[model samples]
Target: MITIKDLNKNFGKKEVLKNINLKIEKQDHIALIGYNGSGKTTLIKLILDLLTTKKGKIEINNLNIKDNKFNLKNICYISNENDLPENMRVVTYVDYILKLTLGRENKLTELSELFNFDIYSSTLIRDLSTGMRQKLKICTSLCFEQDLYIFDEITSGLDPVSKTKLINYINTELITKTVIYCSHILEEIVEVCSKAIILNQKQISDVITINDKDKFINQYNQSFDIGDLNHE
Candidate 1:
C-alpha cells in the first residue's frame, strides 16, 4: 500500500501541490489526470523519488519514501521518454535492463510477438521509427515483473494501434498489480484503471472510481470544460 499526507510543493512563488493526500492499496490501478502544469507529474516524481519531498510524507508499503529503508525492488517507472537509453541497440538495452532488474528474456519475447514488433531484436534504438520506439519502450518496461508500475505519459506519441496494445496489456496482464497511470488522455486509461484522480488548483480536486464509464466521463468532461470526450 502507498500512503501520502499533507503533501505540498512550491517553485519560488507558485505552489504546485498543496495538502495532497491519497491512499493506494495493493493492486489498485489509479489514473492520475489534470490539465497541463497541474502537478500530476510532480506527484508521480515525488513518489518515485525522482524529486525530493520537502513537506510531505510518502510511504510505499509503509516504508518511508524519504528514508534510507525505502526499497525500489518492487517499484518500476516507465516514463514518456527519459527512461530509455538512446545510444544502445534495442536488443542490448533490453538485455541490460533485464540484467539489472533480474527479469526474463521470454517475457520480452512474448510481448514482442504480441505487438508484432520485430525491430527490438535487431535495430538500434536510433534507427527505429517513433512508434516502434514507444512499442519497444512498453515491451521493455512491462517485461519486468514489479508489484508497483508507474507509467508517466507513456503513450503520448504512439499510434492508435500501439496505444490500444499497451492499454490491453495493462488491463489483462496487470490484473493484480498496483499501477499509477499518468496521462492527459483519459479514455486510454479509463478502460484499465479502477479509480480516477483529478488534480487541479494545486491539489487533488477529486478522486473517483469507475463504476459507470458514461457518468464518470461526463463528470470528468465537466471538470475541464470539455463538452464530450468523443468530440475531442
Candidate 2:
C-alpha cells in the first residue's frame, strides 16, 4: 500500500504537484492519465523518489520512500527515459536484472517464450527493433515478480498483437500486484485498469472506478473537451 499526503513539488518558480493526497491499496491497478506537462510524470517520480518533494509524506507499506530506498526493491519502474546498455544482449540484460533483484538466475526461458520474443540470445539490444526492445524491457520488468509495478507509457511503440498479449498477461499473471501505469491511451486504460485518475490544473481532477466501464467512459469523454475521443 502507498499513502501520499500533502505532496508538493516546485521547480524554481513553478509548482508541479500541489498538496496531493492519495491512497493506493495493495492489488490496485490504477491508470494515471492527463495531458502532457499536467504533472502526471512528476507525481510518479515523487513516489519513486526520482525527484525530491518540497512538502509531503510518502509512505509505501509503512516505509517512507526517503528512508527505504533499498527496501523498494519490491517496486519496479519501467520508464521511457531509462534505457538498457546498447551492447548488452536481450537475454543477458534480462538475466542481469533478475540476478541483481532476485539474487538468482531463473525464468529466463519461460518469459522469453511467453512474450514470443525470439531474438538471438546474444543479439545486442541496440540492434533490436523498437517494438522488440520495448518487449524486452517489459519482459525484464515482469520477470522479477515485484509487488509494485510502475509503467510510464510502456505500450507506446507496441503493435496491436503485442499490446493485447501484454494486457492479457498483466490481467492474468499480475492479479494480486499493485500496478500503476501512466498512459495517454484511454482504450488501453479502460481495458486493463480498475480505477483511473485524471490529472489537471496541477492536481488530481478526477478519480473514477470503472464498474460499468462503457458508461464511465461516456461520462469521462463528455467531461473533457480535447477534440474527438479517438475510439478504436
Candidate 3:
C-alpha cells in the first residue's frame, strides 16, 4: 500500500503539487490521468524518490519514502522515455538489469513469448524499433516481480494488436500486481484500471472507481467536453 499525505513540491518559486493526499491499496490498478504539465510525471518522480518533496510525507507499506528508500526495493518504474544503452543487446540488457535488481540470471523466455517479440537475443538495443524497445521495457519490469509497478505513457508506440496483448497480460497474469499507470488515453484507462485519479491544478482533482466503465466513461467525456473518445 502507498500513503501520501500533504504532499507538496516546487521548482524554484513555482509549485508543481500542493497538499496532495492519497492512499493506494495493494492490488489496486490505478490510472493517473492528466494533461501534459499537470504534474502527473512530477508526482511519479516524487514517489520514485527521483525528486525531493518540499513538504508532506510519502510512505510505501508504512516505510517512509524519504527515510526508507533502500528498504523499498519492491517497486519497479518504467519511465516514458527509453534509455537503454545503444550497443547492448536486448537479452544482455535484461540479464544485466535482473542481476542488478534481483541478483539472479534467469532467461525471460516467458515474457518474450508473451509479447511475441522477434528480436534476436544478440541484437543491440539501438537496432530495435520503438515498439520493440517499449515491449522490452515492459518485459524487464515484469521480470523484476515487484509488488508495485509504475508505467508512464507505456503504450505510446505500440500497434493495436501489441497493445491488446500487453493489456491482457497485465489484467490476467499480473492481476495481483499493484499497478499505477499514467496515460492520456482514456479508453485504455477505463478498460484496465479499477480506479482513476485525475490530476489538475497541481493536485488530484477527482478520484473515481470505475464500477460501470462504459457509463462512467460517457459521463466523463461529456463532463470534460473532450470530443469523441479517441482510443488510438
Candidate 4:
C-alpha cells in the first residue's frame, strides 16, 4: 500500500502540484489521467523520489520514501523514456534486468512469448522497432513479481495490436498487484484500471470508478477537454 499526504511540489516560483493526497491499497489498479501540464508526472516523480519532497510525506508499505533505508526492489516502474541500452541484445538485456530485480528468470520466457517478442530475442535493442522495444521493456519488467507497478505512457509508440496485447496481459496477469497507470488513452484506461484519478489545476479533481463508462467519459470531458484525450 502507498500513502501520500499533503504533498506539494514547486519548481522555483512555479507551483507544479499542490495539496495532493492519495492512498493506493493492494490489488488496486488505478489510472492517473490529466492534461499536459496538470502535474501528473510531477506527482509520480514525487512518489518515486525522483523529485525532492519539500512539503509532504510519501510512505510505501509503511516505510517513508524519504527514509535512508527505503528501497524500490518491490516496485516496478516503466516509462516511455529511452532508457534501455541500445547495444544489448534483447534476451541479454532482459536477463540483465532479471538479474538485478528477480535474480532469476521468473516467467521471462512466458512474458516474451506473450508479447510475441520471442521471435526477436536474438536481435539487438537498436535493431528492434519502436513497438518491439516497448514490448521488450514490458516483458523484462513485468516478468518478475512486484508489490507495486507504475507504468507511464507505456503504450505510446505501440501499434493497435501490440497495445491490445499489452493491456490484455496486464489485466490477466497483474490484476492483483497495486498498479498506477499514467496514460492519455481513455479506452485503454477504462479497460485496464478500476479507478481513474483526474488531475486538474495542480490538484486531484476527481477519483471515479471505471464501472460507468459514459459517466466517467462525461466527467473527464468536463475537467479536461475530450479532444486532448485519446478515446480509441
Candidate 5:
C-alpha cells in the first residue's frame, strides 16, 4: 500500500537517511526498528509528507506523494502525545478526529472505554496524566477506520495493562490493516508485526520475516549487542 524508492533525507549538511527503499503490501503489519536517532521518525514523517521529499520518491496506494495526489484520509498516524490538542476537552478532540477521518463518532465510546479513557471525556488534555494522554491519543487515532495506520512510539507512557489492551486490540481488530509500527519494545514488535525492518546507520540494514518470536528477539538483541530491547 506504501512504496518508497531511493529515499534520502538531510537537515543542512547532516544526512539523516540514505537510499531507503521499502514496500509495504496491503494488510502487511511491519515493525520499523532502529536505535535512537537512527531516523525512524524522519522516515515516517517523510512517508506521511510531514517533511518535504526533495531526495527521492514516496507513493501511497500507487499515487505519488510528491504529486500531492494521494489522499491521506485513509491513513491514520498516532504519534507524540504532546502534539494533541492540549486546549480541547477529550470528547471534543475525539469528535474532531472522527470528523477529520470521516469516521463515526459513535465509535469513540467503545474505543474510549477500551482504553479506560471514558472517564476523562470531559477533562482537558493538558490536565491528564502522561499515560492518560497516551491512551487518549490511541483512542482518538484508532476510533477511526483507516487502511494504513502508522504508530510511532505509541506505547510510551502507557501502563502495562493499557499496553496489553492495545496489543490485544491490534492482534485481533487490526489483522487486516496495513501498519508501520515503530517501537523499542522488541516483544511488542514481535507480537504485533509479521515482518521487521531494521534501520541502522541511516539506511535499511535488514528486513526479516518474523517466524519465531523468541528466535527473532534473540537475533535482534545480538545484532544490536544489547541484552534487553524490550524497554523504550
Candidate 6:
C-alpha cells in the first residue's frame, strides 16, 4: 500500500499542497483531477521522489519515499510531456524498451492493432505526429506489467477512437494492479479510474467514484471516507 500522511508542498512563498493524507491500496486506480495549476504535477513529482519534501511522509509499503528502498521495477510511469528519444524510429524505440522490460516485439504489433495506429519501424520519432508519438509512448508503458502504473495526461493527443480503444485496453489489462491516473479530461478519467480525487485550493476537495456514465455524481462530502471511495 502507498501511505501519505500530513503531506504538504510549497513553492517559494506559495503552498502547493496542504496536509494531504491518503492510503492507496492494491488495485486502487485513482484519478487525480484538477484544473491547471492545482499542484497535480507537483504531487506526482513528490510521489516519484523527483522533488524533496520537508513537511510529511510518503511511503510505499513501509519504506519512506525519500529513503528509496523500494524496488523500482515495481513502478511503471508515463509522463505527459514528449520525452521520448528524438533520433530513434518508433519501432526501434519500442524494441529498445522491449529489451529493457524483456517484452516481445509482438506486443507492439498488438498495441498497433488495438490503437489502429501504424507503427512504421523506419519512421523517426521526430517525424511522427503528436498523436502518433502519444500512441507510441503508451505502447512503451504497456510493454511492462509493473505493479504500480502512474499515468499523467496520457490521453492528451489521442483521437477519440484511439482514446476509447486505449481505455478499453487498460481496463482489460490492468484489472488488478495499483494505478494512479492524472488527467483533466473528466470523461477519460471516469473510464480508466474507479475513484477520482479532486484537488483544489491546495487540498483534496472531494474523492469521487464513477457511479454513472459521464456524470461522476456525488451528492455528499467524501472527505471523511477515502477508504470507501471504491464502494461509492
Error of 4 at 43 (Å): 1.4
TM-scores of the models, in the order given? 0.91, 0.90, 0.90, 0.92, 0.93, 0.87
Rank list by lDDT: 5, 4, 1, 3, 2, 6
Give the per-residue lDDT digits (tens) of candidate 3, residues 1-232: 9999999999999998988999999999999987778899999998988899669989898888877445556788886596778899877887677677554334356777878874347898998889888888877776776789888988878888888987887798778988998988877887789888878789888887777768767656644534532444
Model 2 lDDT at residue 227: 46
Q: Which one wins by TM-score: 1 or 5?
A: 5
lDDT of 1 at 84: 60
Candidate 1 lDDT (Cα, 0 to 1): 0.81
The C-alpha RMSD of each candidate to the native structure, in angstroms, is 2.2, 2.2, 2.3, 1.9, 1.9, 4.9
lDDT-best of 2 and 5? 5
Candidates 4 and 6 compared: the better one by lDDT is 4
lDDT at position 230, candidate 2: 37
* Clashes per candidate, residues 3 or more apart or on different chains: 0, 0, 0, 0, 0, 0
User: Which stretch of 10 consecutive residues in model 5 shows the poorest summed lDDT?
Assistant: 223-232
The predicted structure with the larger TM-score, 1 or 2, is 1
Candidate 2 C-alpha lDDT tens digits along 110-218: 6667778863478899888887788788777777868999989888678888889888887888878999988877888877788988787888888888766677677
Candidate 5: RMSD to truth: 1.9
Model 6, poorest ten-residue lDDT window?
223-232
- Candidate 5's displacement at residue 187, Å, is 0.6
Q: Rank the candidates by TM-score, best first.
A: 5, 4, 1, 2, 3, 6
Q: How many backbone clashes does candidate 1 have?
A: 0
Q: Tens digit of lDDT per residue, candidate 4, span 1-232?
A: 8999999988999998999999999999999998888898888888888889679999998999878788976788888888889998877876677667655464877777777777337888898887878888888788768889999999978888888988987898888788999998888888899999999899999898888678778877777777876656
Q: What overall lDDT goes with each candidate model?
A: 0.81, 0.80, 0.80, 0.84, 0.85, 0.79
Compute the lDDT for candidate 3: 0.80
The count of backbone overlaps in candidate 6 is 0
Count clashing residue pairs in model 3.
Answer: 0
Residue pairs in candidate 5 whose N, alpha carbon or C atoms collide under 3 angstroms:
none
> RMSD of model 2, in Å?
2.2
- Consecutive 10-residue window with the lowest summed lDDT within model 3: 223-232
